[model samples]
Target: MAVLSEEQSMLRDAARSWVQEKSPVTAFRKMRDSGVDVGYDADAWNEMAEMGWAGVIIPEEYGGSNFGYLSMGLILEETGRTLTASPLLASGLAAASALVLGGSDEQKSEWLPKIADGSVVATLAIDEGPHHRPEKVEARFEGGKITGRKTFVLEGMAANLLVVSAKGPDGIGLYLVRADDGGVKRQRLQLADSRGAANIELNGAAAEPLSGGFELVEKVLDRARAGVAAEMLGAATQAFETTLDYLKTRVQFGQVIGSFQALQHRAAKMFTDLELSRSAVEAALTAIDNDAPDVAELASLAKAKMGDTFHLVSNEMVQMHGGIGMTDAHDAGFYLKRARAAEAAFGNQAYHRDRYARLQGY
Candidate 1:
């Protein structure tokens, strides 16, 4: 396990307690059943902002705590543990990442404060293809207007502002567009985990250009992957923990299944996998914090490893739970569904594996 500083440890503890008490797994089920348009509770988001989580990575001058990305990752891990559904990652973290890396003074002055206060819901619209392909951004930007379609945009259904990527005369550029602008259209997607997403089509939408453009887009993408990897780590750990609890109490063939040698071995393997994933995610977050030269490669490595590990752990959780696990009434299945969604979020294990190899020049 990675050693945490006093502050990060406290943040993790506080986040875990808050999620458990205020918005546990049951809250997610309620939201899904409620058939709400946003698919998340507004009260929970405000509570998170009140807790200073919304500004965990933003600069203090801009109404943020400026604690950095590692601090943000700690909070994400806690949220992932309970399958808490919120735009904290999609809007708060990912959108904030783009602004922090690329936003000019005027842009930051106007948007950061609102983002920090949870008043403005923002998201990234980078992938312009049917899948996760940053290189496939073919959206057009001409004469200060954007025109193209982006798919699988996280939190796109509920965003008021969008950080869109388009091919400009210079190169791939990042442009900010108002979600309700005249030329924007969105179609909500039904994800496996019920986390909200959308396909957006932009037609001659006016935009404000971020300073760093493509370079900043790369940085933001790596940071987003690292954040998602941390969340996956938490979910995998939780699933393993839940399965362990079930094994201890569940009876099988006149004995507790956990007491059996075969079952004990499976538990041990899961524990080891979870620990390995923890190490990779922690390394990636630390690399980003220090501005390490190899941060990009580390992010890809962590994402691939964590996604695969979570897929493994979540599957085992369902299997170990036996028949009850297959039923919708059981929470074990939720973890598996969430794992599937997250695994495919930024990129799946296969996508990142290829990315890691390319980064290594293999």
Candidate 2:
């Protein structure tokens, strides 16, 4: 198991408590009723920014905490538990990652400050089609102009900026494109999880090229996938815990169902699976943070294994809770929805499994 420093542990506890008190499951229920896609509670978002969560992996020079990836993982896990929908992951983790990994000094200096203060929301638009493969980026860049469409961009509709991937004469590249650019168009896509994302159409949108090329995009995508895996683990952990609580309190057949041998065995298996997923997620996070030689391979492994764990844990959680679990009024369904969405966010289990095998030189 990976250990956190005292301060990191304290920050994690604080984040957990803050989310529980300020943005509980009831809050999510309210957002669901309001027909909001992102479920971004402004007050809650402000509070998180105040606590420096928006800068979890940003540098100090950019008015950020410069905490590092582990701290970012901790915050993401807590957010996952609540099924909180916000631009935090899309902007804070994904966009910020692209900037740090590939942005020029001037770009970082200008953008990181706004991101740290929550004034700006950004997203990485990498998938040019339904297939979600970075290598399949068909967006074109020529003479400082970008032209193409990207789909399934998380927070794409709400983003102030977009880090878009494209194939240029120099090879594949990343470019920063302002959301309000003349030729850029965005249309929201309805996702099962109710998060805000968009299908973006860019017709010769102006762009500023990032410093690094294809390698930089690959690195940032790996980081984003690893982050999503951590978020999935967090969601699975909370789902298991919530289901356990329900089992303890809901009595059936003259006793708590949790006490029944069959359900007990199921819960035990869920726990084991959850722990295994946790270990994989933690390993990926650590490897990415340390720039370990095997980061790519480990990230793929974590995503593949944890994606399966998320599906199994969430499905069984709903099963254990019976009819109420399937109802929209219940919180268990929210967890299951988020699990499904996160599993497919960057890539699904099959996608990661193939990537992992390739990385292993198999």
Highest TM-score model number: 1
Q: Write the per-residue lDDT of candidate 2 for residues 202-237, one digit (tens) a residue.
A: 999999999689988888888888888888888898
Clashing pairs in 2: none
Worst 10 residues of 1 by lDDT: 128-137
- TM-score of every prediction relative to native: 0.98, 0.97
lDDT of 1 at 2: 63
Question: Candidate 1: RMSD over Cα atoms?
Answer: 1.0
User: Clashing residue pairs, candidate 1?
Assistant: none
